[model samples]
Target: MPISGFPEWLPPQRMIEQFVLDKIRSTFELYGFAPLETRAVEPVETLLSKGETSKEIYLLRRLQEESATSDDQLGLHFDLTVPFARFVVENNGKLQFPFRRYQIQKVWRGERPQEGRYREFLQADIDVVNRDTLPFHFDTEMPLVIGDVFRSLPIPQAIIQVNNRKVCEGFYRGLGLPDTAQVLRTVDKLDKIGPDKVAAALVETAGATDAQAAACLKLAEISASDGSFVDRVRALGVTDPLLDEGLSELLQVVETAAEHAPGLVVAELKIARGLDYYTGTVYETQLRGYERFGSVCSGGRYETLASVGNTRFPGVGISIGVSRLLGILFGQNALTVSRSVPTCVVVAVPSEDKRSGCDRIATALRRRGIPTEVAPTAAKFGKQIQFADRRGIPYVWFPGSPDTVKDIRSGEQVEASAADWTPPAADLQPVVSAG
Candidate 1:
């Protein structure tokens, strides 16, 4: 009776997840991003302030509380960005300017369960915020850091597709469409609903003419690995100052990515990010051969998401869908760990009286930075060895005369000291890799 959207991993799979998280965390830290965490729950209105994700937000209510008129209603956060915005505003006076932080936490959503869509999942986010203004270079830096993380992992390559909200909005306004938000929300559905439905939605919902819809679709279709996307958009015969600004900013991002992580990023004009808070560059990532699964990582820039009266914090960020990524890799059976458990060596108990001695030896090994465990029972040597083998423990230590350790797999025994002897580096910890 497992829940459909909330997934649990086995020991080995959990190890794999931890390994991926470590890689992502180390990469974020390498780029000088500090770590941060916000509360899981926020006022329901704060959650709904960023986007039209009201249907996806899980509201909180006490079962014993009968009154529905409570003013302090809260909901589980659907994404890291909104809570992060609230955090920046609340902590404005205590923090320094140009705050760079990385947050890895579980977020709950109420979306219907399906492949790659989880009601509860882990997200790793890195954002850089500054008072009043944020530099455009921060947008370029986001994808580079993400590219490095993917490169360091054993998973398939990820291509980050980028688009600026300004480009879409400006283009729509240039086309006589007034409601840019509705147009963006419709264009964001281009991948899921196809171009025709998106076109119809643009006309029916966003008040776009057939020609404007076709032009919008054409703009959406423009994608390039390099700066060629600029000319493509220009060729559409649409021009606006804000669109020009977005084009210049987006080109810089693409060109920078081309210089550092070539072919790892592309300019995809249709990446409308849907969220009303995203006022500038937006990003979506796709793993090679797993495009149908949707974005495994995404985020964008916001100029007004974090505001407290006259003060404002503008920021740019990207979030990695940690659970979604691991789920897909685990489903494909593409990841594996050296052992199901972290125990590298198991000390055999010669007898019930000698169990205390085995524990002492285990403690000595553990002090030497080795993951050691004492055998559960004082059984025959063969039976004790089997116990170690069953759990994939590489070594079985015998705490007897001379104190020898046996490599269970190789059946090789050697006299060793608990204080001085060390396992090979590779065997010291569970190694995670692609199968």
Candidate 2:
């Protein structure tokens, strides 16, 4: 069989993915975020408003041959954000102020897939949508919260660079750039294509003058830092009211987040993300050493992104690309699965009558939260112990023996009551750790 970048691991890899998800989910819930899920598809019109993302969408038709003529259709979701917006708008009345939700699910993109990029992949997203106004502080807090989650895991140190679309747009317009949107598209690729190509595109494509192009290049250059970066942008003399307004709002978010999570937020100006829907704050997270993974997680705040009966639904969020993060970590040997699959303490039965004793001990251990399995058949003590070692099960319970347990690795046997015996937490099962 053949496989693409949609990399799959054995039991070990699957266990690592679960570990990453648990850490992300715990962090979101710690901040009072609830959980939510949306259907895989929405009406085409609902999706079209998402701008460039729609181009990456995978369409589902009644029949592949009749797709052109059929109005009956659906498209696999490319991201969780858009469908979540629709959900908030449809159910806005029932939601309370600052409704926080975390969604972990699969989103599909039919675009050409590559390493760390898949036709189908899982995304774990945490979002905050307001019944009315979503305070800008969350724009700063979102990344810190996400960074905190990533930091909690055994994964490497990851950084989240944040920007506001309003600031980028307003700054471009103030500089006499005609097509700010097109200018942004070029700037967004600065990391991939580099500064020179971006500068040429700004001048040739967006009609930016030599001075404007230089100033634009400066605007696009921001590094990983705290809110101090905001002062650098403010020092520029040539600016307009729109630019000033965007800067002010952007400043508030950084200050607000720093007050809570000290040294967490940065007022990066270069994050001209390609998404047109992001009205205010935008963000991208890169693993410290693995910047080539592109962004392990990225998202932003979109104002009035979803409209239910003309009522604008505003929200802010960030998503953890579970599959990509796992793939990279797996490749680097940063992930470790300590326990074998399923079987923990295999209760050995030396005789046919002893099998019943083994079964009783297994049940007793399982009730105490130790995942225990009985030996497949009656066997010699040494053979039974060998089976446990092969499965990475640390302890073997020989029920007929006066001493019921042996640490297979250490070869230490001890006598204990079945109901009272407990394996060290780490030995209970194979633990998948970035540590």
The candidate that wins on lDDT is 1
What's the lDDT of the predicted structure labeled candidate 2?
0.78
**If scored against the real structure, what TM-score would every candidate get?**
0.97, 0.93
lDDT tens digits, residues 343-366, model 1?
999999888998888889999999
Cα-based lDDT at residue 345, candidate 1: 96
* Per-residue lDDT over 1-435 for candidate 2, one digit per residue giving the tens place of the 0 to 100 score: 655645566886787777778888899999899988889987766676688466677777665365453245577888898898888877888888688999999888766777778878999998888765777777767877886897688777776677777778777887888687898898888888898988888889888888898888888775435555656676654577767777777777666656766555566678866767888778787887898878888898888787766567688988888988887777778888886576778888879877777788888888888888888878777888878787678888776547468888888888888878877777776777764
| Model 1 error, position 374 (Å) | 0.9
lDDT to native, each model: 0.91, 0.78
> Which portions of model 2 show Cα errors greater than 4 Å?
53-55, 62-70, 256-263, 401-403
Looking at model 2, report the run of 10 residues with the lowest lDDT sum: 64-73
